[model samples]
Target chain A: MAFPDRFDGLPAAPRCEGVYKVTGDTRGNNVAIDVLGVTKVFGAADSGFRALDKVSASIRQNEFFTLLGPSGCGKTTLLRLIAGFEFPTEGRILLDGEDIAALPPFRRPVNTVFQSYALFPHLTVAKNISFGLEMLGWPATKIASTVERMLALVKMEPMADRLTDQISGGQQQRVALARALAPNPRVLLLDEPLSALDFKLRKEMQIELKRLQGETGITFVFVTHDQEEALTMSDRIAVMSAGRILQVGSPREIYDRPTERFVADFIGETNFLEGEAKVAGDRLLEVRLDAGATVKATAPDAALHAGRTTVAVRPEHADLVPGDGPADLTGVLKNIVYFGTDTHFHMTLDNGVPFIVRQQNTPGEGSGFSIGEQVGVRLHADAAQALKD
Target chain B: MQPHEVEQAAIRRGTMRRWLLSAPALVIIFLASFGPLFVMLAFSVLEKGDYGGVKPWTFSFDGWANVFFQHDIFTGELGFADAHLSIFWRSVRLSIITTALTLVLGFPTAYFIATRPRKTREIWVFLVTIPFWTNLLIRTFAMQEVIRNEGVINTVAMRLGMISEPIQIMYTDWAVLFGMTYVYLPLMVLPLYASMEKLDFRLVEAAYDLYANRFKVLRRIILPLTKPGIIAGSILVFIPSLGAYVTPRVLGGGKNMMLGNLIGLQFGKGNNWPLGAAISITLMVVVMVALLVYVRATARAGGDDRGR
Candidate 1:
């Protein structure tokens, strides 16, 4: 696990046996959490639910790391393991290079902002914020000052005397965050903390969370099903599916070049076209579609190229052309959808497959095509990505 | 004919229908409660008969006066009624001890039943209530057999060579306490289990996550949250133990008489029906006062009860 010095501070690249490869710097590395082949199974051994199947991940210090997936995808299970709520069934979790697997949740220097906020109903907001500090046996003066500081940090100074159940959902969310941060844990785990808020409030809290992370500089491992929230907040994202980590990369890397099938379909809207691919050049792929069109696509991993595979393309990667010249595929325009900032032109190809082309709206200019009209979509040179499925 | 008048007439008809539907229950409650209360009050102010019954239409204050003081046979002076006072004191003291003991024993039992898996919880609660299927007198006599001389405990101890003589436990206050606590235990556990069942266990996990150990979680979270159940169970056990006649009479063996047995003594052999009725009224007053103080302290402990 030699982390290269160049990638040390910027991205904190994860280097594992099957995930990444790095060189040069081997010492003086700061790894906040290294989950080594963690497996979690609920109930009996013979007949049990395998929530996580030997999932491995490396979260670095002060990184805004996200585990993004749909529901029941082991993201929350992984977060709970890190927060010491659930112990690994067969592996070790190293926090700051120390094995914290044997420590209970109270002994571990970690805190969680649960999705339900789980605040003490009998205590006021200030007492709730200072609960962790009180449990740690800090002096009354120190606890009082810290409670005041947390109240001001969450912008809930006036709500100090109000009970937790008496506050609004958004206010309770702020108090939960402040309470978890009061203890100043080495790592903070958040399990879908923003999923309960409305769209507008969720957006505001997303930015607020990023700001807080930047200010505190604690390693934050956030779990969410919302891909847009993950992309908007994370420094690096790990896309998971079905008790395993599907892919781990930057959001742009995950979106533009998903290495696997489920990752391609899960991250965002992807168009899949079956084709026979051949190695064109160095890191270049020549894919011949089933519809008699030969297009040059970029290989995500050149070493893993195969002959018969599917090429995934995003809707925004292609533009609709009137004639067939300089077009990758020609089809009939089936439908047109207009959004506020973009429009989607639904085209049925000559092979009878549904293909969508998205184009930005330039103020009063339409897509310049009507329904049932013949159209062709031209792909950018880097749009089509070769999947190794 | 008008819409407003028709609507008002319909509203009036609905109110009449509601009252009609509840009339039977209200009438039964009044007849069952106030009817006996009036008879008891009337008998308490009447003159005592020669044998057992009270004389009609002849009012006397001797029954009420005898409650606190007794006239001396030689000096014609009123003195403190030490016998009646001691009996009342013993009843109150035993009831409080019984309530405290049941709470200490029943809390852990209720918590255990509440924390069991949902399917098994019903079985545990059903077991707790199984004692109610039999008669209270039978249960008290069964308990007497366990604590009496030459009974189960003494016989087992002697057989095991652990004692040379039988322990004199049956005709003591300990016997009465044990019997009352045994009979009234289910009353405490049931309400406590009901409250513990509704507890949000995530809060307990949250406390543990925040560095609070097991004792702190019980004291700060579980105890306060289930105060309503604790108060309800205490009152349930305390009221019954206060007026409990069968257990104390069967186990106390006429020497350790409680308020219930003392009041019964007036009616059965004392030949003073007025004094018995007066003592019965006094016992009811003590129960009411105990309930008031318990409720007031519990209400203060839980401000406004909205959280529960």
Candidate 2:
């Protein structure tokens, strides 16, 4: 694949793909967190296990970047490394071109809203918010103004005097945010900040967080396992697995054009058609299925290898036509799930491979197909990405 | 048929079973703990019999009055300037000294052990408590051997030519304090360790992250947070040391007699049961008051995180 001409003027990508890019230019306010080849190992060398394996990604200033991954994927470790709570085994963390890896958490120009909120039980909300200002030796008047401003930002001014233990979990989250932002860090690290909240509160906080990021104009490196959160709030997302970043791009790029099978499966539901790749054209690849059908998919990132591959087609992208067409694959509609927003049809092909087809709930009618009915599943060639095994 | 009835029946059965199982143990504990104390209280107010046994018909304040008001004949052996106040003052001072020394030595040690990694913490706690497994008298005698004129320290100092002659470490107030501290150090540490173990290291980290220096972290975060443990440890060390008999007897010899020694002499050599009982009751009351005050103070200070 040829490099995009637009990226020619941009700084060269780091040699190792997925390693953080830390440029030393002081002119650009766009780059806030530049992590270079960050790695974290738990325990001593004799018994140590690497938690983050040379994983890195730069977060731009004022952008809400999410590190999305399942548990133990080292996303939280990366966030902590950036927050200066945990030093990387080997890496340089530059905050605004200053090497902050050697600096203590207090000295680093970054603040973290821990997942648990970590609000001091003894302190009032006002005190918790003003702690960072006090640390900087700000005068009482300045500290008070900053604290009041932060409390107002989070809409917690009325409850500023309340003890942290007395408030609801959602309110505590806002207090934590207020506290972190009151410090006016160049970058904000949120470690699964919404995981503790209930579903409704999480959604509300997501919107609130996005707005707060915009209002503060500070980079936010949010860590979460929920792909929906990343899709909803992030300007860019880095999908990690097994302590290494698998893919990094905008949410659309990750969801629509995932680079790896793991990223495809992790980000959203997909029916993986196992097959052998055969080049059809410069940009297209014909994957011969194990079950005797051929699938044409757009090659993602790299040229498809000949031996073995899989075509990732999202369930929603595969449409059920009235009857079999020239390019359509025939299947029996085995089941239908009537979700409020969409209707899902589980279909079985002649070779018995189960394929799921999701259709959005349009105004006039729902899915025309029923259980145990014959249907034809059609997918756009552009919707499927050919991935290596 | 109803849920409430079923729950009520279960609760009744649970209560019945609990009472049935604990009846014997409860009775034994009641008899063992309160019986002696009640007997001592009764003796303090009872009229002394011509014989050794108490006269049940007559009760008087004469025994307490004699001990409190005038120097009884037994004072000669006890060697207190005043019969009651002098011995009481000595015991309070010694107990205070023992408690202070125990806190000084035990708090940091307990903090160290508690802050260790989980597996190492268990091992270190076990090491701290190992000395407690032996008989208290045996441990006191062991200390006696170490502090004696020709003991290990003197021998080492002599061999090193640091001193010309053996130092008089044993049979003094210092020896008594040392023995008391050594024996009660574990008692002091256990409660402290329990309190310190619950201390969230994040609190200290949070303090440090707020630019509070090491000393400020210690004073503002660590010390106040571990106040419950300190109070509990002090009570554990102080109450026991006030009435401790074994350490003083073994280490103090005849030179420095604490209240425990005087009480023992009154009961044993002096054969003054009334005086001994009065003194014992006094010590018990003092300890009880001290413990009560500590509990109330801790409760007021919000140190009772245990919710008891």
The candidate scoring highest on DockQ is 1
Candidate 2 C-alpha RMSD relative to the actual structure: 7.5
* lDDT over C-alpha atoms for residue B268 of model 1: 91
The CAPRI category of model 2 is incorrect
Interface RMSD of each: 4.2, 6.1
Candidate 2 runs further than 4 Å off: A1-29, A44-47, A122-151, A156-165, A274-300, A303-309, A326-332, A348-354, A364-366, A371-374, B1-34, B46-62, B66-86, B115-121, B199-218, B303-308
DockQ comparisons of all candidates to the true complex: 0.41, 0.19
What would the per-residue lDDT of candidate 2 be over residues A149-242, giving only the tens digit for each residue? 7898899988987888889999999999988887666678888989999999999999999888767666788999999989988888999998
Per-residue lDDT value at A22 in model 1: 27
Position B36, candidate 2: lDDT: 92
Query: For model 2, how does the per-residue alpha-carbon lDDT over B1-308 read when each residue is reduced to its tens digit?
Result: 69999999999999999999999999999999999988898887877666444578578886676566764475544333464676677778999999999998998999899889899999998999898689988888888889899999899999999998999989888898889989899999999999999988876666655555666667766887788789988988898888888887888877577778888887776666777788788778888898898788867766332211
Worst 10 residues of 2 chain B by lDDT: B299-308
TM-score of chain A of each: 0.91, 0.89
